[model samples]
Target: MTTMTRAELGALGEQLAVDHLTGQGWAILARNWRCRYGELDVIATDPGTRTVVFVEVKTRSGDGFGGLAYAVPPEKVRRLRRLAGAWLVGQQSHWDEVRLDVIGVRIGRCRIPEITHLQGVG
Candidate 1:
């Protein structure tokens, strides 16, 4: 099997993350949202909790990187938090709560992508 390019892998990972979240009843608000601060991979609302979630998606192949979880370091989480706040400020809608989530995807040659979702991270 041919190896997937990094961009392709990332797109696939994000799609997987979105699929997983939606399957769990989350409504997707945005994807690849960008601002001067940074970009949010996915933004969604959890009907059950009436919360708005900002998601960070990290994609990796094999173990070249530390791991999927390691992709989101403390600094990255901090940045995501700031971006989330900025995103909220631009919107007129209000949510009961704001939450952060990280989704990691691991793809191997010809294998199904492995997805891990870490909710309420930041």
Candidate 2:
């Protein structure tokens, strides 16, 4: 089997994350949304709670860089918060609550990739 590049892996992870979220009954608002600061990987609303979630997707082939636990550092969380704020400012709709989440996708080990979703990370 051929190996996937970093970009390919990331794209696949993001798509898998989107599929996972949608499967959980969440409505996707935006994807790969960017601003001056950085990009927000995924923005979706939790249908049950009516909350907006900003998700950061980390993809890896194996347990590297300290695995999923260390995938999103404090600085990264701050950056995600800034990006989320920037995104929220341009919107007319308002959410009662906003949350930061990290989704870690581990591929190439099993037939199906493993997805770990950490909610309210920041």
Candidate 3:
């Protein structure tokens, strides 16, 4: 069996996040949303709160790099906010809430299924 590459691992993490969110009844507005400024891993709407979520997914192979959650810095949060504003402007939706969530995933050989969702992270 071929081992997955780093890119593949990241893709898996994003898919897992999307699935997790979907299970919670959030409709995916977009994925891998990109512009010259930055990229958002997942964008979804939760009917429960009627809020638009801008999610950033970070995946790591192990404890290295201080795990996935450590990857999100203040600057990245700012970038996400900016991109979300652009997305909102383009869609022309009057969102009641704008939430920034982070999904941190740790991939390992034993497949522990590490996932942590931090809502309103930014």
Candidate 4:
């Protein structure tokens, strides 16, 4: 198989993540939402729970950079929270709950890529 570039791998991972979310019946609100702070990988709503979720997607080819658990450190979580706040301020909708989640996509290790989702991360 041909080697995938970093950007291509990331994009593929994000697309897989979106597919996973939609398969779970979640309504995607935004993706790659950008601001001065940074970009949010995905934003979606849980219709059943009436919650708004902010997602951070980390894509990896292997266990490099300490793997998925170490991808979103405390500082990164803080930044994500700030980004979520910035996103919320511009919204006209309200929800019963808001949460931060991390989705780690690991590719090139097996026939199928592995996906790990951590909820309420921050």
Q: TM-score winner among the candidates?
A: 2
TM-score of each: 0.91, 0.97, 0.90, 0.94
What residue runs in model 2 are displaced by over 4 Å at the alpha carbon? none
lDDT, candidate 3, 37-111, per-residue tens: 878889999779879999899876677787455688888888899999988989967788999999887777655
In lDDT terms, which candidate is top? Answer: 2
Once fitted onto the true fold, the runs of candidate 1 whose alpha carbons sit more than 4 angstroms away are none
Question: lDDT of each model, Cα atoms only?
Answer: 0.88, 0.93, 0.86, 0.91
Superposition error at 55 for model 3 (Å)? 0.4
- Residues 76-112, model 1: lDDT tens digits: 9999999999889989899999998888887776467
Ranking by lDDT: 2, 4, 1, 3
lDDT of 2: 0.93
* Clashing pairs in model 2, backbone N/Cα/C closer than 3 A: none
TM-score of 4: 0.94
Superposed by TM-score, candidate 1 places the C-alpha of residue 42 at a distance from the truth, in angstroms, of: 0.3
Off by over 4 Å in 3: 67-69
Residue pairs in clash, model 1: none
Which residues of candidate 4, in runs, are more than 4 Å off?
none
User: What is the Cα-based lDDT of residue 102 in candidate 3?
Assistant: 91
